[model samples]
Target: MFLAWNEITRSKLRYALIISVMFLISYLVFFLTGLAYGLAQDNRTAVDKWQADGIVLSDESNTNINMSMIPLKSLDDVTAKEKAALGQTAAVIQLDKKGAEKVNASFFGINKDEFLMPDIVEGRAFDTDDETVVNNSLKEENGFKLGDTIKLAGNEKKLKIVGFTENAKFNVAPVLYVSINTFQEIRFEKVDTTENARINAVVVRAKEGAMKNVDLAGNDLKSYGIQTFINKLPGYNAQVLTFGFMIGFLIVIAAIVIGIFIYVLTMQKATIFGIMKAQGISGKYISISVIVQTFVLAVLGISLGLLGTVGTSFVLPTAVPFQSNWLFFLAIGGAMLVIAVLGALFSVRTIVKIDPLKAIG
Candidate 1:
């Protein structure tokens, strides 16, 4: 350890450059990982909060909640620990009647009494058809406030912001919670009293031991567990896969880079290793020192990288979906360290083959 550290202190600029490379690479990996996690959570945060065991949708809807249309009477045929009817549609809402600023939002028509209704972080839940609760992001990012009236761009339906809920988003859009009746009027332009009145799907909380039985093929509906539904969210799988590959490749590249640098440094000090061996110093000692040096460099580089990432996250605006998960950072950092150690092992061969007489001459 002393030999490794002493050499580093002696050649401060050389080691600093190598450490800088690791730091930048690690920082990029960590930042991308945060983005990937944030985007995935944005797609399903509201649904995850439901803690529902399963969701029932028409098979004809191709597993899409927005496309599914099941008759309200179908709820009677379903059995579970608890079930709630859900209606969903996408909309662009204007902050004012003049249509100056607009935001994309998902409208979720739910009964205030149902488990699907999220607890309000501020204000109160909607009590009337004209009142709606929105995700707290609206207040932070769009300057929405309690009692602000929101105007639906195309249908001219105006909704009052009654409350704000945290972590309520779907498909990267904020969710608007309104009564089922209001949703029907917005979706169909008129409420129907016929026997065929329909809703998007039924969300269920099944008994602990009955998840496997949640599917209802006989009732012409299909069931999906909360995780399965999340995986099926539009573009969710694709985004996750893309980020996974990128992160994986970056780690591999980091390993190779560390290996090359350490190997080059070891080759430069070959004559020094030979002279030490000629003086009766063991090859194992020199080999161990090389590994120790690599370890020290890796730790310093990764630590600085993580610090940079944290600093960047703090300055980022709320509008940017950046979430910090220490667990992920630690895992990635640990992987980089391990691979760096393994990378240093390649230099052991050079140390082992050093001939004392040739190096001294």
Candidate 2:
């Protein structure tokens, strides 16, 4: 530690440049991670809030909740501790009578009396067919508020926003929640009846063992665990994989860059290493100092980068999806530290190979 500190203090500029590079890389990694996580969460935040064990969708829908159609009668065939019918559709809403600004949104039909109903963050849940509860983004980003009437692009039936819910997004769009009956009317353009009523899926809370036994084959439906269902959402898996590959490649690049930096620095100090060895210093001690210096640099760089990421999140535009997971940050930082130490170790070979007699001459 003493040797490492003394060397760093003697050559502050040389080490500062390395730390700056590390800081930028770490910042990018953290920022991209937050964006990836946020976009993914936007795709399924509403579903995650269900905290259910599994979901039942029509077999032909290919695990896509948006494409699935299950007759209301099929609900009876699903065996679970509890279950609720869910209806889904995509629509456009007009913020004003002039229709100058329209926004795409996902419509979720849920029974307020059922477990799928989200807790309202502001105002109260809908009480009438014309009243609706919507994601808070509309209020925060689109100037929507309680008592504001939301007009559908082509439909004459206007919905009045009665409440706002946080973290209620689906497929990256804000969700507008309505009663199952109202949803049936908006989507089907007709009142639900005994023979024609249908829902997209059945969300259930059941034990893992029970989920295995709850078969819907007779009803022409298939069940999936919650995570499996989330993975099947349109574009969800693809986006996650794309970001994963990018972040992974960045990590590798970081390791390579740090290794190269250490290698070059070690080569430059080869004579110094030899002289130290001639003075009776052990190669092991010098190698340990190199590792300690790398660790110190990584810690400082990662800390600054994390702080910058957090600061950026606060000033980012509302449209940019971003979410922070400290645990994820910690994991990434820890991995970087280990990789950096390994990189330093790789450069230590140069120090070990330094000849005391040649260095002194």
Candidate 3:
């Protein structure tokens, strides 16, 4: 430890430059991961908030909310402790306020009186067909306020914003929570509440594994775990996989670059290594010193990267979709440490091969 520490202290400027590069790479990977996660979340954050076990859809719907159509009575087929009959559609809202304009949003038809309702961040849940709740993002994205009247596209209905919520989004758009009847009216342009009423799907409260048994063959129904169903959302899974692969490749490249860096440094110190061996230092000790130095450099790089991420968050524009997940960061850091160690292996091998008799001859 002393040898490694002393070497790093003596060549502080050289090590600092390498650490700076690592910091920038780490920050890039982390920030991009957050952005990818945020985009994926925007597709299903509303559903995630339900905390439901699974979803039951008509076989023909192919796991898509907008494509599914189930009879209202299908809700009764779900043998669960709790559930909600939900519906959704894409619609545009025209904000008449000075600083606001028309924005595309998703309309989610949910029972406010039921457990499926989202956590209200401000104000209260909607109690009538004329009232609606909006996602928290809309407050900033569209300059919305409580009691502001929003005109629904393709319909004459004007709903007053009653509340705001977090994690309420669908298909990459913010959600507008309304009564099931209001949703039916907006989606189907009807007032019928029962007798041949159709809904997209039924959210169930049983364990995810148990949802498959919730078959309503009489209605030609199928079910899937919450996460399983989310993956089927349009373009959601594909986007996640694409970003994951890209980030993974970048990390691998960093490993190769680290290997090259250590290889060059070790070659330059070949004579020094031979002299140390001639002075009675064991190869294993030298290897340990190299490992310690590599670890120190890795830690410094990762720490600076984390700090850079935090700093970037403050000045980042609100429109940029990005959210930090601790688990992802931890995973990245662990992978980096492992790679850094592996990168130093070439140097260790070179050190072990140095001949004591060749020095000072």
Arranged by lDDT, best first: 1, 2, 3
In each prediction, how many residue pairs overlap at the backbone (N, C-alpha, C within less than 3 A)? 0, 0, 0
Winner on TM-score between 2 and 3 is 2
lDDT of 3 by residue, 1-361 (tens): 9998898899989888878878888888888888898899888898888888898888888888889988888888777767788888889897755555778899888888777788888999998999999998888876789998998768988899999998788888999999988888888888676768877888888745477545454647777789889999999989999999988987887777766776787778788888998889999999999988888888888888988887887788777788888899889878987898799998899899888777445
Q: Worst lDDT window (10 residues) for model 3?
A: 207-216
RMSD of 3: 1.9
Give the runs in model 2 whose Cα sits over 4 Å from its true position.
208-210, 213-217
What is the TM-score of each predicted model, taking all chains together?
Answer: 0.97, 0.97, 0.94
lDDT of 2 at 88: 91
How close to the true structure is residue 241 of candidate 3, measured as C-alpha lDDT? 98
lDDT of the candidates, in the order given: 0.90, 0.89, 0.84
In model 1, where do residues sit more than 4 Å from their true spots? 215-217
